[model samples]
Target: MKHVPAMQSLTPAVDARYQTLLRKLITKNGIGGKDSTAFVDDAKKQKLKTDESSIPLPVFEKGIHVNQAPPTSSNGLNGNSPTDDSTSDLSKTVSSTQDDRANDVKDEIMRNVLTIPMLKYDDLKAATDNWSDANLLGRGGFGQVFKGVWLNSLVAIKRLRDTDARNRELIRELCLNQYRHDNILPLYGYSFGGAEACLVYQFMACGSLEQKLRSKSHYPPLTWSQRYRIAHGVARGLQYLHTMTGTPLIHGDIKPANILLDQCLMPKIGDFGLARKGPYGEERTHLKVSRVHGTRPYLPDEYLRSRCLSPAVDVFSYGVVMVEIASCLPPIDRNRPVPLLSDWIQQQARDGLDFASLEDRLLQGTPHSNPGLCREFVAIGVHCTKYSRGDRPTMLEVYKRLDNLEFPGKHYM
Candidate 1:
């Protein structure tokens, strides 16, 4: 791996370049990632396959949404004249509009009181053979996800250890119907009052990204194209969580283990057990806590110290994940002296270490690839993991720049 310059080597030119890059991508007018139709189109064009027995993506109303202000032109909905009966008609219209809004609010409340699909303990026992180790797919912080057949199709059942503490996640999942994005994993339902309190989801054909990265021998090393695509997908998912959705979600846990893969090798952000409804208006999002939930390396310093939870923590974790993906290495290897991929990469970059060699090291035998693109991505990761949350770019901005990145032979201006 290439070592960038240490902090001491950050010359004026390097700082200027970095600042210039950020300014170029982040326009002052508005957010950068609002228009990403091109990138979504490119992902659709990718024709990668994975090892699965005829897998299919669940259709969950992942439709296009556009949020715009009400029109202000005369003779429009707001236009009104007040003469004789005109005033009476306008009052009636306003009253009806208010009534309609009240009804919509009532409907929203009913939606939150959703009727979750319940499953009996007997059914889960039958499917998992009484929670047999043979059926266990993997374990999580608060539960273990078991692979089992449900209603003639495969499903992942996460058996929660603490139902009282973790039930909120299931509620959040249901509420995120307004927050649903294609790259986000869908929650099928939940089963409480059963022997095992659990949440159900569509089984990811290729499993978690962590599995693929670790078991390179079993699964081939992901090509640069694949990694790039995965990065973009993950970013869009985060963007949806941060901005696109009505209720902003702080995923709390953002790591490769939470990122699952589908039949086409596409990425899906999963595991909302630690998710929380983000702050709004003047509301403070920071939480005072004695305990923090997350992987050690991925947790930012602020999160550990003040327990001030924010979307920036997820962004920081994403930065670490980015480093891992680019270098095709784990966050930390105990056996190796220099552990924690993001720190090492950042230290190298700060020290003016030659980043040129990162491509050959990370990309391996891929003779046809884009090193410039890889370097730029690494830079983004470093910025995300910055010590100050104020410095990190919003998830939308991250997606915008990433989408604009050109592939090997292509040129864009």
Candidate 2:
């Protein structure tokens, strides 16, 4: 008689009897109950060991196995034993499957982020409150600008008139170098799939310098010191854009209306759709631009004559700004062929006029006004406005001269 295991007793009585008869025959064939039980238990233990060994170790975190292997029995219990080569092949298959799954997950994440939907035409209309007149910030040659809020971020959206391929290239270039300067309006992104093209930029709170300069009756007039700082900031920004290496950028248009101010009165240069880069393979020397851009009063005479422009063109524009700051006069008058402001300055310089009359009228009632300081500013202005571009000083030199000028006493008039 063979001692059968208790688990075998759970099987049907008839099957148990049959297994018992087979065990007896094996015993007769020189196999005993103890040897058989030992062999069965050994087979169970080996299968359990293989299952434990097949469990993969966690790669990233606990309980997160990357490649797990299937369980397989070994020994005479199943009448089949897995070969060492089969085990190795199973492991390679499991690893490859896990790798493929990981790659698929990575691809899915990248696709999701890259395909984030841009603003559609209807979406923009809704965000801008149906392009209401109340939301209008300003308008320019490109198109109208609007103040909009999206995802809690305030943005200035420029709705462009034309969406040609050239304009698209301009947007790409501007966006690429948007992070180059702190005093320039940065391009966040753009939308051009609809009937209108739109450019997005960081919102400027205080509007443009033109508004500030022309707002004598409404907002408080900017002081002399404030104007000087604003002018310095603008010069530094232009210098960065014009002189920095790796494809020099030429701001074809520079004017008061294009200079924006923040709440702290810091000036920021904007509107670069008309900017041009120097020719390739050529060292980024001064640009020889031929286009007659910028406002007439601010335009250098060389540019008017179609001479190739250099950074001096910007310096010439800065000189015009200096005159505006000094005299508090508008840059142009439609009624007059020549701007009264520039004509007056040229006339004064020719007559060897004194600096007293050039002082801004806003300083007339201020007790801090100093005639000597005014003289220094006027002299600097004269040097900047020299008829020849070669005679004009660089923005760096202009900044230093302005810095050296002494400010009057708090109560000195």
Candidate 3:
């Protein structure tokens, strides 16, 4: 059989590793044996199924924006409490149907993961001290992460909750192993069956960008320079996802919580649970979804209204994250004069407030703070958050603008 060409633009070592992986995959597909020439053509045509059942496409009630929206009635309207036994029985039936669907998706994921390297469930459990609370790293919509030691190396083990979201994340993360970059979080391995489904990832000593932004003394405050680098790193990672991959991928969720930082504060984008592959070829600009599924303030107007997704959706979310980094404020805080931080920032900027007046209070008087750089940075974010999808800059443009920002003696770029 003919060999697949090694991917271009990768280092020799990375390309060699990819070739090794390709050969192993060919063998696993039963295409490495003699008389396997015919099988190669068929394998090349195989692609991931993108249907609702196969892709974990979420089904949300008509007006729901967030994943944790309140329950709606049978007729798809907000209804008062049911006062009859029949209503209770109906709820049970709906729950059963959801459970069956979740199991089917989980089964498909368990089968797909067979091709990857796996760790023993018991060994992972032991590494985390039987999943003790003390070892907990953080929690997300899909699972709880714990810090652990595996093969004498520090790792983060994520024990997923038994739900459709978990299945979706598991499959997406599996796909990430093939598209490695310096800014993307690396997957070490996975463990499944027995008691829980777990994915092991390279440990981030500095935790998530969200944690650092919201820190109230548990961790040191992030200097202006660190925030600048964090934004640049995240932009590079998102740009890679959009244009570098063979098929452009949209990281549907790009909140600060998904961006992790290493000990030196180098940022790596993580959590592909909500990621979706964008349409292929230049003619196709967007992918239509059954319903909108993402966090608020980060989602763009077009995505929410039309359910049409493109790389711009990710760009919009990244813009919101930029605002977060500059302001050191949560995306949504009901107590604030403006509940949505992105909107508030835009309003304040439009009101002609200087960067010094708009920046995080803690950043004021700090030696690293530079009003000129901060203004330029916030302007980039505002440009990305434009109401019109066509108006926002591509991630590449965003990266270039960030790269041009003056940060003296910074070598990471």
Residues 106-221, model 2: lDDT tens digits: 23322322332345566667678887788899987668999888667877887877534334333333333533687787766556456676766778898988888788787777
Relative to the true structure, how large is the alpha-carbon lDDT of every model?
A: 0.61, 0.58, 0.69
Runs of candidate 2 with Cα error greater than 4 angstroms are 1-123, 163-169, 172-179, 278-290, 333-340, 368-370, 406-413
Residue 334 in model 2: lDDT:
67
Put down candidate 1 lDDT per residue, 257-308, tens digits, no spaces: 9999988778999977667644433344443222356677887777665455
Q: Candidate 3 lDDT, tens digit per residue, 48-77?
A: 332332443222112222222222322111
Instruction: Output the lDDT of residue 19, model 2.
Output: 36
lDDT of the structure predicted as candidate 2: 0.58
| Candidate 3's TM-score | 0.73
Model 2 clashes, total count: 1
Model 1: colliding residue pairs = 4-348, 4-349, 4-353, 5-348, 5-350, 5-351, 5-352, 5-353, 6-350, 6-351
- lDDT assessment of candidate 1: 0.61
Lowest lDDT block of 10, candidate 3: 6-15
Give lDDT: candidate 1, residue 402. 88
